[model samples]
Target: MSHKIIRSLLEGRLKAWAAARSPALRIAYQNVVFSPAASETYLRAFLLPAGTNSNDLAGAHRLYTGLFQITIVAPAGGGTGAAESLADELAALFPLYDRLTKTGFSVQVMTPVEPGPEQQGDTAFALPVSFQYRADTT
Candidate 1:
């Protein structure tokens, strides 16, 4: 896919998510790990509950309501593929994809790490995500 499309979406989503966090969340990179071209790469991101808000409920509680995990393959550029660029692209594309498909989905990316020695051709990435939803009780 075009890097521009990927970059815009990823940055947009990350920015939106950071704003939602209030204190503002910076991109965390330590959790990132690169696999041999044959294995999969993984990134994990967490969305925590906002500490305070304008509206208050008597019994309101801080709830960890979401999780987004994203795994993507490296582009063919060779030297240090575009992890950040790809992450940003995914961030933006996800919300739109969810909206279009009308599904409850999330995206997450782990921090970057060194590439391992076991890599082979066609590097792979796996982003395993889990989401929870409540049924309409009305």
Candidate 2:
């Protein structure tokens, strides 16, 4: 329940931001089929739940933690400049200690957004930017 709300809150923010970009970046959301045209750059979003644990003896309090990842996929052979720039923008979007709340659920960014090493493939280069998030509830 809370996990779903957390996902919605985070993904909604990403979706809104993408829609407002000048060229309107496309995002391949979870379980959605997205086929970008050749040479088109896009993003893929994933929510990886770390786990949930009871925080109190009576299980009245709980803690949820997870990693939210966004992968930037750009055409192959293009230097990493474009991908890196987008990564920077995304990192800034979810700053450390930021909080998103909805339906009585609140999730906080637990770490600075970190960009992983680039993964090169025949058709595209994927640079993943990820951050940790935590939520608490009673």
**Candidate 2 RMSD to the correct structure:** 0.8
Clashes of 1: 24
Residues 50-131, candidate 2: write the lDDT tens digits.
Answer: 8899978999988999999999999999999999999999888999999999977899999999998889999999999999
Give the number of the best model, judged by lDDT.
2
RMSD of 1: 14.4
> How accurate locally is residue 108 in candidate 1, as Cα lDDT from 0 to 100?
28
| Model 2 TM-score (2 dp) | 0.97
TM-score of each: 0.26, 0.97
Model 2 bad stretches (over 4 Å):
none
Error of 1 at 2 (Å): 33
Q: How would you encode candidate 1's per-residue C-alpha lDDT over 26-114 as one tens digit per residue?
A: 44332445344333233434432222222336534322222333333443334444455455545444533242111222222322222
